[model samples]
Target: MGTNTILDMRGYRRPEPGTQPAYLFPPYKSTLRRAPTKPLVLLPHTLSEVTGPVFGHDAISPGDDDLTHANGGEAIGPRIIVSGRVLEEDGRPVPNALVEVWQANAGGRYRHRNCQPHSPLDPNFNGYGRVMTNSEGRYRFQSIKPGPYPWGNHSNAWRPSHIHFSLFGPAFVSRLVTQMYFEGDPLLPFDPIYNSIPDENARKLLISSFDWETTVPDHANGYHFDIVLRGRNETPMENKR
Candidate 1:
């Protein structure tokens, strides 16, 4: 096995209470149907779950990490840079972690056909990107800021501007999913998904902060969002049932 093998079996810390969303958060209407009706059967992580399936740089094509330019023309909207580190519970770097993101365009519509047709689509933005974290555990991408979109979760329920993130650990089974919200979106307070996490501080971890250092002059603004795989301060992950 190579040095990048993530086989340390020290075991991950259980997320502190309220740091993660409940499987049955009623306000997030989708969970009402999908949440398990019975107690979950815990599965132990074996060798297959903890190691192998490495992601190398060869999988990344030019501009794969830059959503704004990946589809040829620049994506429409206010360009922004999102950068962060993928850290372990103890703050160790997770090198070569595959971080993927997808989101709606500035018009509050996703590129998928299932998305509502109420908003105009930007021909330039497919709104998907992936990058491998560096040896220092840092990853970055450039994209237009996503816009809020109304959903059927509640009456007049418009989702906050956000980006969806998926991180793959050593194995495919270790993949974790979460969302990143902008620092000051007013819609956040009303978003059921955002409020699903019971702890105020834990919910705050999902919001990215503006970063002057990463902001490019006359180009994209910057936001920094560090993701902790697990710990007392872990980012709220989507409930997996």
Candidate 2:
């Protein structure tokens, strides 16, 4: 790792406890039976554990960040551009951090087989993108607005259109990921995953804003999102509601 990467990792501060509520979190399943108990074994943080996978120049293809035209075809949906910056809690830029994203297509369906049976998969849309932050901690990509899909969590749970993001910072501990949402989506009021977060403002940060300046005429609209990995004001995941 380079000097900047080391600094960013060293600055890592785990999120505060008791902030993430249990009921709001969607993926954790509810069961009536008692859960099994397990022991906590401390693991050593060796070089392998500290550093994630490495990549080279050849690993990235041109237009890799543009999901609208993947596999030499245009996806059927309203094209949009997502732009953002990755920063440390102290307001420093995290340069060259690898950012990976995945989401459903305009049809609220994923290309994967396990997706719900009702939504049809789009042959033209792959719904994934990967890009590295620039020297100033900035990154941008183009994709379609994913639609809401039904779920079994509640009587009629449907996940809001969202993009899942992953970031690899300098160290293993510094690695973090989050989901980004579009602003003003009516579904925001009812989405449990979005509501899982205890802080209202923190949840608002996940929503992106429309940017006319970044929008291309007769082509795609523009959206801007800024990501602050961990800041002095923000802590990592918490157990408290």
Candidate 3:
């Protein structure tokens, strides 16, 4: 019988400890330069109405037949009316705010690059639409339920059913890019886009609630997603205006 003994080698280094490395590393300093602080400048501008003629060659035609054909087609799934009010943080109506939305077709296919092949693309589904808010800062769109599509990552890889929203506020200072998702989607936790917003409250703001009341005459399902844009708060002195 033979027994093997192991030796304890605790501290062993090839070169040496505390060896200074030679490199040109800049001194660490705060990159933020202090500016001459002044009172915040507030600009005044009227909200633009989303109705009537607007410049932008890409605006979709608001033809009733377009909506009808989109709803009646087999590839076009459930018809829904997405309506909401665009308001300021103070709850004031943001008239004339441009709200553009793009989403996957009812079959859960998008008009983008690197899409899956198994999912059938809707021939009628342009997968794009836009709307402008009314006088009361309200906007509406006729669309269908977007199907959840699988990504190449895993068998369960699916994005939460969502619609991309782009808002151009009254002033150039008021622009925002965001997306709306359906509430209670199982894929929310796994979807990268849905998880992009770190703030829970901010994330919740993007999910629309199913509103049966907002359904159109023949439509059974509808969703309401109100968006709030940043704006100047009215001061007490401004009440005189």
Candidate 4:
């Protein structure tokens, strides 16, 4: 890795709102009542909330970044390299961030009990992985491409192939959990979870592009994905007269 790349800070991704249709958004026949519509009331920050629950990752497993071999043998799928950097809204690197990732197997099957009967679980792949940012605020993972799976959100709702990423940055407020999708995934247009994002550009931010230069011969295909924790500024919303 060379000197950390200073990514362009223009048009950063928009944060996820609580009203996304697949998970948070409430519908008419939604058994759970929706939260009362109200403007967000920003409160003063507290010392306790600011600094608490520090994690010690000294004993992190060495195999954490290699999901395919973490269990024992190689997982059956197309091998690929997932590389990215964690940066702040101001284009500063956020070194030492803990990134936890989980995904379905190459067959689009999770190891969870709920999915046991439907999709065969790969004994060679448990589908969980993690990595910490290096001095340059960069991290990499060696894993197989996850497959798409169907969710009965609608008549035939199939989620696109994606990897779930949980980022724990310096501050408690910097903790963010988001899903990263691959570029040109045909299922993106039909998936409710992917389409929940209202902004097209914001949705594009969640997708990763393949990097031919990063591709290693006879090793794994490389995909580049950079995460910007938050935006530097927020456009205020005011009621129209």
Task: Find the candidate with the highest lDDT and give its number.
Answer: 1
Per-residue lDDT of candidate 3, residues 1-241 (tens digit): 2222111111111112222111221121111243324664443332332112443523545642123254445446887778889997668898777777788887788877778675887777766677778789998887777878877544567877888888877555457678889989888887765654556676788899998878767654779999987655344233123
Off by over 4 Å in 3: 1-60, 64-75, 152-156, 233-241
If ranked by TM-score, best first, what sequence of candidates would result?
1, 4, 2, 3
The global C-alpha lDDT for each of the candidates, from Candidate 1 onward, is: 0.83, 0.76, 0.65, 0.74
Model 1, 198-240: lDDT tens digits are 9999999999999999999999899999998753223223222
Pairs that collide in candidate 2 are 15-235, 15-236, 18-239, 18-240, 19-240, 89-230, 89-231
Better of 1 and 2 by lDDT: 1
In candidate 3, residue 167 scores what lDDT? 86
TM-scores vs. true structure, each candidate = 0.88, 0.79, 0.67, 0.80
Worst 10 residues of 1 by lDDT: 232-241
Worst 10 residues of 2 by lDDT: 232-241
Q: Rate residue 122 of model 3 by lDDT.
A: 79
Backbone clash pairs for candidate 3 read 48-96, 49-96, 50-96
- The residue-by-residue lDDT of candidate 4 on 94-155, one tens digit each, is 78888999999998998887874556778899888888898888999988999988765667
**Count of clashes in candidate 3:** 3
lDDT of model 2 at position 57: 43
Clashes of each: 0, 7, 3, 0
